[model samples]
Target: MTTTLTRPGALAASGHPLVRPQAARHLTDEQIAELGVELDAIRDDILAKRGATDAAYIRRVIKVQRGLEFAGRGALLFGRNKAAWIAGTTMLSFAKILENMEIGHNVLHGQWDWMRDPDIHSTTWEWDFVTPARSWQHTHNDLHHRWTNVVGKDRDVGYNLLRMDADQPWKPFNLGNPLYNAMLAPVFEWGIALYDLELPEYNEGLKSKADLKRDLKAVGIKAVKQFTKDYAATPAVAMLTGSGKQALYGTLVANAVRNVWAHAVIFCGHFPDGTDTFTEENVEGETRGDWYVRQMIGSANISGSKLMHLMTGNLSHQVEHHCFPDLPSNRYAEVAVRVREICLRYGLPYTTGPLPKQVASTWAKVFKLALPGKGHFRKGKPASA
Candidate 1:
């Protein structure tokens, strides 16, 4: 096989937003090869584990789900109470969110093999955990990776209402109230569906709009069927079904809690008040490496407990995950050391740590931006790590 590949030429652009803040920091061809080898090995481990996903891992996943549902239910039922129990829950739901953001959504887009099998390399799998490869893959892989923060090209710039760019001002969302915006984000897991799924499906380059229309129509049918089944069975639905009363009853309780935990876990990562949320344009001129570095810095990591970071896969270490996404998250703390060295070399902030620290940092930004004359673009100035 012969291929003449060319880098996007990000480093060469002296005007790149990242060039000044970051010096000429790059992996040597050889160094990159070594890292590739390291990642390949980790993929093997992941695969082996998957092969043995046996009763134990399955049980653990189930147990994790059970706990997640419980916490989620508590949050839904006792809204404020669930928030109070934030410290009580494990990292399972949190991991699920990042997993959904990066893994589930994109893997759904069609990169499951690469995620499970480390031997292939046609598609980029390293950052697939955060950037996604499906609908998101287009933004991160084609747009963000190539344009790296460019205004129009990098689809990551919108806030559904607020422009992340200082140059533009357009209210994109109807955030009814301040508290609603703050508190409701967790339950709205559909934020992903809205941004990645809906936006593209309705607008953008819908290659064959007619084809998409047909597909959507089919999907609508499936949704209706599922809804009909649920309505016939659930107490909440307008059309309640009278099926295996015991099983139906149990499912309702289990499902309600499961979804809440799943959403809460994910909501905690980026939805907190303080994390940086900017337009793609502000950082457009930045290098991919710098944008890569910033995503880590701008986003706050919960740095949940070791078991949490471990089982949840260091979603708390969002910075590390973005810095060297391919590296096994177990090595996130270790790789974070290297990333910190790079940040120091480049004078960039290395944002990360445990959940309490993450929560504090997140809300600090929220409160800061909430204050008059404070919002930076829309995010307020960067916070200390």
Candidate 2:
């Protein structure tokens, strides 16, 4: 059976807030209650601010994304012009990133539910991803955000391929994970598309073959639509105009850039050095306050400028986002300040660092955990590995 406890005592006080020791340890019930109340206040304040301003923000972002996409595709028709190819691919990449992160992710999270706009609502909005939005919402929003870092419950830990936690049984196959992780970056969406089918469940007899087949069909449909748009039709148009080869190459490159960047931003959120993973038992009888505390310790955040935050779809505030997944995306930065103050008052570790450092740390973790003798050993406590 999997262990059911959180080993907070294992953490050591690193200088960075990202690795501050024992952020969640030794909190009395009273303290947990107090923190919970304060957190609710922060959530409520952000909720209240979700009005015309938030609506306008999302609309404007969508407008910008559409414009960039149009211009990028138009420029790509100039195909063989090296400068146009470079500029168009870059613009397309940025457009894809904005659509996936700011628009698709947040919108599908129901962050814009208050607007009551069906066109933009989670129910109606499909993204450029190969994974159907319904499947993604279920796996990501319902499962991932709900479970956060609980070892057995959250498939997101290493995403069913990498052994993220050292305690996970290591096999010789894992030795190639460094390479696997690297390759995964450029094709991350494809990996996720396959994963969203939950094939493991069907193999384990937890899900039926019929259900898996249906899901696979859905994925195939989405994949065909995506590929036709990006790979076939767009380039075919250019080809007819004598720029086919360049458009094809440019779109492929742009997709690679968007995929890898998204992978990096997402990996930096959960797998970085200071982030904690929990045993399923740790959440037994968990309260809302306990859930909030779990999210705080289990997720790490990226520290960066406003543009960086926007580019990341404000997922730079991953901790804040996990804490209130349904909250308006734009409000996370504001809530983060209040959250840090609460963390200070309650002596919680508010883990955050610059983007480069965080991404590097996460990669270091991937490499280290791949070899897998043990994970970071904490002082005086049983090694989590």
Clashes of each: 26, 1
**Per-residue alpha-carbon lDDT of model 2 for 57-162, expressed as tens digits?**
9999999999999999988988789898988899999999999998899888888877889888988899977799988887898778877887788999888899
lDDT of each: 0.41, 0.81
Off by over 4 Å in 1: 1-186, 198-208, 211-288, 310-313, 326-331, 360-374, 377-385
**Residue 361 shift from truth in candidate 1, angstroms:** 4.8
lDDT of 1 by residue, 1-385 (tens): 1011123334446563422222123444344334435433543554454433333433354355457545543333222233423422323244344434334433333323434444223253332121223344544444443443344554544334323333333332322324444543543433433454444535666546775555445444544554454324232331132223433333344333434444434434544543444444335344334445445445445655666654444556655544444333344565556655655654445555556565555445434433344344334222220
Error of 1 at 80 (Å): 25
Reference-based TM-score of each model: 0.55, 0.92
Clashing pairs in 2: 4-281
